[model samples]
Target: MPTYAIGDLQGCYLELRALLDRLAFDPQVDRLWFVGDLVNRGPDSLKVLRFVHDLGEAALVVLGNHDLHLLALAAGNSRHAKKSTLEAVLRAPDRDELLHWLRHRPLLHHDPERNFTLIHAGLPPQWDLAEAQVRAGELEAVLRGTDYQDFLRDLYGNQPDRWSPDLTGLKRLRFITNCLTRLRFCKPDGTLALTEKGSLENHTVGLVPWFRAAGRKTRSDRIIFGHWSTLGYRQEDNVWAIDSGCLWGGALTAIRLDATSLIPIQLNCKGYLAPGQD
Candidate 1:
């Protein structure tokens, strides 16, 4: 079966439908891997969430930062102001079911047979495949556990921005969450520079895209990720970025993972949110 990895949807259901149609995707045969952020910022978050949730075995998703924010808001963690176009989801009749399914989504997905890993954002240079799996599991357990609300309450911070074996408790979980869902640039020593979300050409000195960081352990493995829409579609050093900024008028993109060469299928999107709107 061919596997198609898609970029962040961000609630653009119309664009998603168009893109899938363009690919002539058959849910019965072609497997879909979504790089998270399935909801928020677009006009149809509810529809998008419902469609993906109903895909069942045909779809695999790793939670994005926006997805996590939705879960946090649903959990009553209102530390940050709610600025997303997620009200449709929050008020949906099936909100509980949808949020429950979203909360259970993994932070990282790996397919050894295909030699590709999926994450919403980049992994720290220090973690090899095994270490990344272990760290992701730790955070996943918290998000899926009974005490998830407690964790969500403390989840919105940028402190402890660097990874360390000695880091513990919420701090450790926060670091892991950021790397898996929101990371972009990092210092040469592997410390995350979370504020730098612009494209690589505009990056400051000594900061490198996490994938290009020195001695990255997963550099040997093919990585498929999103969360850096500003960087657009990138394929370099075994890393593939498919976030074509669908909400920002870029294309909703998908690339076939079953082929020797990644082939992108895109549908031009109507800009739902202008640049700097979010």
Candidate 2:
């Protein structure tokens, strides 16, 4: 049995299927770990959600920013900022069931036996695998609980960008949320730069990709993450970044995680949306 970690789908259902075909994947004997953003901005978000949801125990997932945005929209707590391809999913007859399943997904996943931690975006330098899991649980409790709508309403902020053991309430939740789903770069002290969507080499000073931050606690553990399409495919510094901007004319990628070597299986994508659209 093989377990593959896939990149952000962003509703590119056909590309996902194509990539799977290239892998010769069999759900009965193979498992999948999705790095989130399973829907948004592509042609077949509803189909993608339905397909992944029906996979049951064969698929494990962490929630991405777009996935959370869809949930927030379903909860009537947030509006789509620009273009959104999630309306069909929201209006589907099985919308409630699908959204319910999605809402319960975690922000982080760590396979202790394999020693691989999976997240949608990036982790702050401050946390080790243990603290990361705990903080993720804190936010997960709110999103999966009855007060989910209230938290969703307050989800779209950049305050409390720096993580602290002293942080509490919504502020704490928001900071954790940003780091897990939207983080790309940060200062050495783990101050998150949520707005910096460009690549790390874009002449930015004093800000490094989260994995490159000094004294990162999880530096010794392998991490597989997506959500940084602009950063492209990276497998350095004990971290693997698999988001290849499939919705933005890049390729959809999947890496076999349990294998001793890393060679990404890629499927070229149609330019459904231009770069920077997201």
Top candidate, metric TM-score: 1
* Alpha-carbon local distance difference test for all models: 0.91, 0.89
Instruction: Estimate the TM-score for candidate 1.
Output: 0.98
Q: Estimate, for each residue in 1-278, the C-alpha lDDT of model 1 and write its tens digit.
A: 98999999999999988888888888998899999999878888899999998989999999999899889888788765458778888898999999999999999999989989999999999999899999999999999999999999888888898888999999999999999999999999999999887788887888999999999999899999999888888899999999999999988889999998897888888788897776
lDDT (Cα, tens digit) per residue for candidate 2, span 1-278: 79999999988888899999999989999999999999988899999999999999999999999999998787775556455778899889999999999999999999988889999998898899999999999999998899899889777888988888999888999999999999998986888977877786783688888999999999998999999988888889789999998989988989998888889988888869888664
Number of backbone-clashing residue pairs for each candidate, in the order shown: 0, 0
In model 2, how many backbone clashes occur?
A: 0
Winning model by lDDT: 1
Q: Where does the lowest 10-residue lDDT sum fall in candidate 1?
A: 77-86
